[model samples]
Target: MQAVKNRNSSINSIVESVFDKDAANFWLQKFNPLWSFNQALGKIINKDQTAVDTVSLTIQTNKKFKLGEAGQHHPVIVTVNGRCFERTYSLTQLDVDHVLLTVKRVDQGIVSNWLIEKAQLGDVIEFGQPYGDMLLPQPSSPLLLLAAGSGITPMYSLIKAALKSNVSTPIQLMYWMKHEADAAFKAELEMLAEKHANLKVQLFHTQSEHPDSRLNESYLNQVSNLENTTVYACGPSGFVSTAEQVFKSAQSFKSEAFSLSHLASDDVGFINVTLTKSHKTVAIPKGQSILVGLEQQNIQPTHGCRMGICNKCACNKAQGSTKNLVNGATNTEPGHLLKICVNSAQSDLTIDL
Candidate 1:
């Protein structure tokens, strides 16, 4: 059974990676310019904590806003203490007139700290239109939702959309966090589980005296059949990377990561990338990231969570070697560092892009 699962996972990874390339390109060409143009300033209605810090915005826009997918994210640009910064937060309220975002302030995090402490009601903030391909599958398909921390924002939107659409497909969610207090929308998820027979929810706390010790092989072994599940995951980069391996082992996993800035480190390395389509050769430098180099050359790769959390920067390492600055680039070890936003080149590399 384990071997079968492994084979299935490998196949799914290949397939999903292919799909990711196509989907990413499509969204990049279609939405990037439009999203850039529709960007506007919004007013804060309220900023408070709901497990973490949640903020609501009342957007002042004359143009019709494009509704985002359940799991999509948008940037919130704000000036705090006179310093301007931008942060990407997932859309919690999908298909709604007003915008809502929930975030946890990491120590020294410029934007999060500003949003949590100083942002006043009615304060104007810059924001862009909805843009992301990490959307939920069609309502007809069975769903497997996984999340941790603020990553739950997107899943919350998915569940709400499913309920609003009167979806009947079987949906199972496994949410793992450090403590119960850190779990967002627990009551809401429980309420949905009670209201809908097709929806099943599971909460896993790593620190609690629970049956499972975090999400692992055992926890996955007990989940429903993987053959029919479409997996979605978000959260810390390390957590997301670990979960992606587990899900890819059992089912098809679609992931969005939100950790990037914190992963930058002074790792001396070099890699060669031959852009097949561009017919160009670029050498990635030590301590510098591939995405940074690519962006410098006017190759604006699709990215969110420029800090390396969002998988938007995931690229195929067609040949050569690289190291993931985030999560230690485990999968890329033999030769497959996924996200360039947080990874450095170890040797000459070739990418399908």
Candidate 2:
């Protein structure tokens, strides 16, 4: 048996030395689309409309894919019209080989629209290793999950994980949506709350007949042990900011925003951005992310999780000034690392792209 194993290893080494991996994988994919040398690929097996303009897809991934923590995000890559596009989304692991990806349609969003309208069952998509920090901690504390609109997706993942782990602490979720019909996993969440005594689910609709007020201090009355609970909030930038202010008294706070709010900047008009590696210069608008500006000029940079937490979009600012959109901080230092997804050009800049 040992000699046979050694012979097989020798044969494999010879085959690897003789054939290029890309060439081998090209032929391998002809038999099975998900087969690859090392790439993580998933096939869409099921699709369901979870809410108005929201969809949930069941993806069965190849063995190369590594499952991430409950609240982590994965960089999903797909090609549309021969052009590859990558976007990050939170995934809920259903089992060892399956995950649920929920997407909400955004107006003028190219990838979201394609995933909703064009992607079909048996279609294969590429995935990057999961990246995020908002995860459940050991020796758990009470959890306060605050979500707005599509933000509920990650919270749902965290909730199921917490319950499955037998976390005894109270888990309270407050989700806000424009209308009740916009709520994804409404019945599922209610069912979970019914089954788990420690889990509490609340839905707030701002556009309903009896509208609920937006995030404010008054809502704090409903949450018990406010000062002892760890809080996780996800939503639009404005909603996250409001949550941060409202839940300042929590034991610890973590947040991720799906969209960034436009920064109010005195640096108006376009600024020239010089790409050092490409030896090209383009003018991009101030007060907007450098990533968006680059995309406007059809310059695609490798990026994931546009929320700035993934660090995949970080590049060196070789010269000039930039302002951090999240905190409104300015940096004029040369050769500083800048996350193009969250930093706006404040002046003519040269970047190591």
Candidate 1 residues 52-133, lDDT tens each? 4544333432233545677777777788777766678776653345666677767788888777777777666666566776
Q: How far is candidate 2 from the true structure (C-alpha RMSD, Å)?
A: 3.2
Candidate 2 Cα misplacement greater than 4 A, ranges: 1-18, 264-267, 274-282, 318-320, 327-336, 348-350
> At residue 292, what lDDT does model 2 achieve?
97
Give the CA lDDT, 0 to 100, for residue 60 in model 2. Answer: 95
Model 2 lDDT at residue 229 = 94
| Error of model 2, residue 282, in angstroms | 4.3
Deviation from native of the Cα of residue 59 in model 1, angstroms? 5.8
Give the clash count for model 1.
Answer: 15
TM-score of each: 0.69, 0.89
